[model samples]
Target: MTGPGRGTTADTPVVVAARRTPIGTAGGALRAVTVDALAAPVLAALAGTLGGPVDDVLLGNVFGPGGNPARVAALAAGLGDDVPGMTVDRQCASGLAAILTAAAGIRAGDGAGYLAGGAESPSTTPTRTWADGTVYTRAPFAPTGDPDPDMGPAADDVAVRAGLSRRRLDAFAARSHARAVDAQRSGRFDDELVPVGAVLTDERPRDRFTPERLARFRPAFTPGGVHTAANSCGVNDGAAAVALVPEWRRRELGVPGLALVSAATRGCPPADLGLGAVPALAALRDRPRSPDAVEFTEAFAGQALACLDAAGIDGHRVSPDGGAIALGHPWGASGAVLVVRLFHRLVVQGRGETGIAALSSGGGLGVATSWRVVR
Candidate 1:
């Protein structure tokens, strides 16, 4: 709960290093890789630069085989058996939740350093069935009596309620792809990426998507819905992790990083969960200034636009290099991917002094974290 104004500078948690695997579409290049396998390389990449032991390893995972994937990944990454690990699950917000949890622990004087992030492998996730031989794609986000629409339909509802037109949504999606393609060509994503197997770059961003092509697609969720496959993120497989240390330790290591300023998580109506990020961003306290750069998960163009509009943030201020709409969304990993992108932009590229990473999740959850570049 402690933020910049509430805590001493020396004790503030900072992200010294961040890395992520190239996101791959489900059943594509990363199909053979398990969740732990996808996470191990990213963890190893961060740990290799630390030069000291990590206090713990924390990972966010959804739909994994579930034997403590964090611990499995730590061992696979060769981080020594002494380093303990824990897994967290908060649907799509899991990754950001893990990072915030680590920062909270550091603020509480629990540990000096930690490894936290998220990983998801939709390609290798197993099918689940209830004891009564009933099959289900995912667990219910709300109780039986409450609204629990699937994400696609929920996105459609957001578009309808927010008065977002199909054309506007399509344009946003096309712009996302165009920006990602441009960033890719400019080598903007080169340094943050860690090769997984033979996958070196994100597999989802296309070279182009004309408005006419995007308009030809039919509604994907409701009969008259504005949501479509092109405007939504793809199911993906990938992992991302950050090396978190207290400010004192960051100074000792002599590395630039992101100083944790504030973090918040909020809840909204389950029926309109796609708009969750608005409330979360509003909950942050002691925010000294508006973020110069923001990395918001673009799970669905309509949902993203609705949230951004409600929050009174300009679309151009978010994900200048594109977002999940182009990069693909690997469930648990998507939130961490946002932070990784911010780290690259704020710390590596020296673009801004402050930045934010925000995402909306299933079950009406939203999470937002603010950081300042510590050079």
Candidate 2:
């Protein structure tokens, strides 16, 4: 487990070039596309720019294909026959875990060289069936009954325990929309997105939001569910890919946005697993000059606040442009999506230097990752 700051006898890993599809709501443009299909163009874009096959392909898919999705996406995107793939599931933290694994592969001098990024999709998501004739929903937010309480109900539970009020949730949703609008208007996302050819039957690239648009949606979970469409992470479709430089060749192909800071992934108690980020707080609290230095991108408004409060993060610095609440969530790719968004905000704009993407997931589990932009 040799990692950053261990005097680990090598340079920390860095991102060479990274790009993602503009996220869109399900049944939208990419709705008909396969989870791997959405990712193909993104992989092609990165490869075309980088001029070769990547070191590997790592995917973060929670509910789609059950067998070797990472490898499938790798082959689908023209990554070449030799490149291997690893599919990881960390609830929502899957994408960052993939990124870190790729980074570690490079730092380990294992000759892994470069890695491609990925996340989940639900529109064409893989569905499961039982002999009893019951169907299981696989879309990002597909609501399937659970013998155990689920993330939505769990959010209600967290709300009751944390005493989060309806007013706060509404306000947070509003701010998320406003900030997402700001991000789009200011073109904060221009650099992060790749122009995957127009999704068939679609005209726009990324999901668009506004405070007013969210204000009209009603509650979702319960008859009077505390969570509303605007207040929750929208069911969305998208893909992301980033290249990692091999330690042996970092200097020769030094890309403009190269950066290596630190990252960690942790687990949370299952019963209240949606509250996973609790551990990430202590992991990053003592960071250098990291004061007033906290930023987080989470999948849900209720849990993001609850987890941050649970982790004792400084509230002011969290997802300045709003998160899933505004940007929408594509499940499997969520962890990586949040970190890339944070990295771009920090590296591209002049946002906080240190940021954390932490959140809980469906099962009694959660994870977090840390990142610092290359200066």
Candidate 3:
């Protein structure tokens, strides 16, 4: 499915390296770690995997503590001072945007190869002081319109417009948790999730997830709304990194079975829009028929479903292993996280159909990438 001169073929794009920080709920140990420390371990792991220095490091970050994120992460990860880097900011889609940028660079022969990935600590968010003296972090960036509204209001409006019932929404959320529990039990995520050692103040490192405890928290965005704290994604801390190597150079480093497939980027109207995933889906599903399956990060269960419906695909075809609702959505990291999850699913499922990963960002933007299973 890969075209010639596209830096890919029918072979798997070699994943030279892969690593991630343990995902913690907001205000967790990762909050204790600096952004540089937050991103360094994963990059270091990637460098060690490739056996040498890489050409560039692409990072996806929504809220950095302060200072230049890409440079800080690169330096903290032990890259040379001269090594180039770029920080991507496309809202939630920033991670996938970063991946596309790095992939394009390698495909264009800009450098020997490159690293593309994302990191986020939504826990340590940057707050803004409004004239009313209300401190907020994510409100200013959520959807807005004539009356103006935050993401929650926009989501409520989306639900109303889509005719999504509370019953249906609850079912969707329940399904996500069930699937995640199953995937974890079946070892589907073991291949990707990295466990990090940490100290909680003066205490020892302990597991962060406890289903019983997680079930106790109430809704975050809309307290009385259908999206509960248990169901809705929260501020989280985690980092993921991947290496992209051109097909021709696969043998030089003894890495094989990897390639950059096809990708598409597009813009949509900015508003409390009803459908954000249409343009990107239309572009990637350009070949013959609808995509075999749609893999989207669960920014919100209903909103994610809206995109699938807009694309004219069954919602069931999306996120078979659960989504942000269960795995947690860390804003900028969700885009690349979707790609990484899709890649793993394609590799393990032994299916031949192409997969599409699409995400909607703030400011009416949608981006998608297509990956053909390398057999």
> TM-score winner among the candidates?
1
Candidate 3: regions farther than 4 A off: 1-16, 130-148, 199-226, 251-258, 285-293, 348-353
lDDT of each: 0.89, 0.64, 0.65
Model 2 agreement with the true structure over 1-375: per-residue lDDT tens digits: 222222222456766567777787887767677777777776766665443446677777777677777787778878789978888876566776677778777777664456656666777776687668789643233234533566676676776688887667767767766766777787778887866567422122234444455556776776666677667777778777676664324344543344455555555545564676676555653343443234454455677778877776655566776567767777777766665676576655656555666666665555565555443
For model 3, residues 125-175, the per-residue Cα lDDT tens digits are: 667678999875554443344344556655666666777765566566667
Range of the 10 consecutive residues with the lowest summed lDDT in candidate 3: 199-208
Error of 1 at 255 (Å): 1.2
- Number of the top-ranking candidate, with lDDT as the measure: 1
* Over 4 Å off, model 2: 1-9, 48-53, 138-147, 199-217, 223-225, 246-248, 256-260, 285-297, 350-352
Q: What is the lDDT of residue 133 in candidate 1?
A: 85
Better of 2 and 3 by TM-score: 2
The TM-score values for the models, in the order shown, are 0.96, 0.84, 0.82
Candidate 1, poorest ten consecutive residues by summed lDDT: 1-10
Off by over 4 Å in 1: 1-8
